[model samples]
Target: MKIKLLVVGNTTDSLLKSLILNYKKRIKRYVNFEITELNIFKFRKIILTFSNQIIRLFIVEQLYRDFTIINNHPCHNQ
Candidate 1:
């Protein structure tokens, strides 16, 4: 069974990033998932503003420790 992990968000917080990494590590055993930015248009920001929360919830509700979204980047060791 292939599950897609979509870590869609538009924030740049360190805690959020760490969570994403943790999600990735936990979901690599089931499907190919990665982190991706929610591409909301300039004018459509209003629509996507509250929608991101729904997306996040959906990810949490349906995702397991074996799914990936497929946009992950390497963390810097600086």
Candidate 2:
């Protein structure tokens, strides 16, 4: 399965961006990972447009702080 990360805001800190990019690259080796960054306004627009799909699972960053753990999951290898 493909994972799409929808970030509502951009990270202005270069160090943070670099860290995120590094993790993204590592995650890509195990699964089809993607990160989509959108400003607050655009994110709000999307929320309004896709209100019907509100039931979908939305994993917040705080909950998945260590996303790299996916590399250890055997199911993702498929």
Candidate 3:
């Protein structure tokens, strides 16, 4: 299976980006991994369009202080 890491905005910090790339390289050795950076507008558009089909979303705060797991069910709308 392929794992995709999607970010709503660009990572401006050089150190953080380098660290992320290093981890990405290591992860690629075990599985197909990719990082996609999308602008806020496009990201929101995708979420609105696919909200009903999305099963779960894992979100991490900017400071990495906290994270959230959102679960969605199609039947919930019925």
Candidate 4:
């Protein structure tokens, strides 16, 4: 089975990236895992102000959709 981890932005910290890669290597011993870092867009300040909690909620909700789709796909189990 293959598991794909999709991320919106690249991790800037070299140490952190190395740590993640090391963990991925260990995990790959038992499963097929891939990490795809996507550079979609740069963050820009929004004119409309929203509370931090509200912004977090919206982001989580949106991410949930992507995860659900990935999880439900037949490839997820293979």
Best by TM-score: 2
Q: What are the Cα lDDT values of the candidates?
A: 0.50, 0.52, 0.46, 0.52
Tens digit per residue, CA lDDT, model 4, 1-78: 677776655555555556566656644654576778666565753332234223433443344445546566333234
Whole-model lDDT, model 2: 0.52
What are the per-model C-alpha RMSD values against the true structure? 9.1, 9.2, 13.2, 10.1
What stretches of model 4 exceed 4 Å from their correct place?
42-78
TM-scores, all models, native as reference: 0.45, 0.53, 0.52, 0.52
Clash tally, candidates in order: 12, 0, 0, 1
Candidate 3 at residue 68, lDDT? Answer: 12
Q: Judge candidate 4 at residue 48 and give its lDDT.
A: 25
Compose the digit string of candidate 1's lDDT tens values, residues 18-69. 6656666566655565656656555554433544644554464346421333
Looking at candidate 3, what is the lDDT of residue 21? Answer: 69
Residue-wise C-alpha lDDT for candidate 2, range 1-78, written one tens digit per residue: 688888665555555566567656666665687888757685354433232222122232322334545434334234
Tens-digit lDDT string for candidate 3 (1-78): 577777665665555566566656645654576778767685353443233212112122211111111222122214
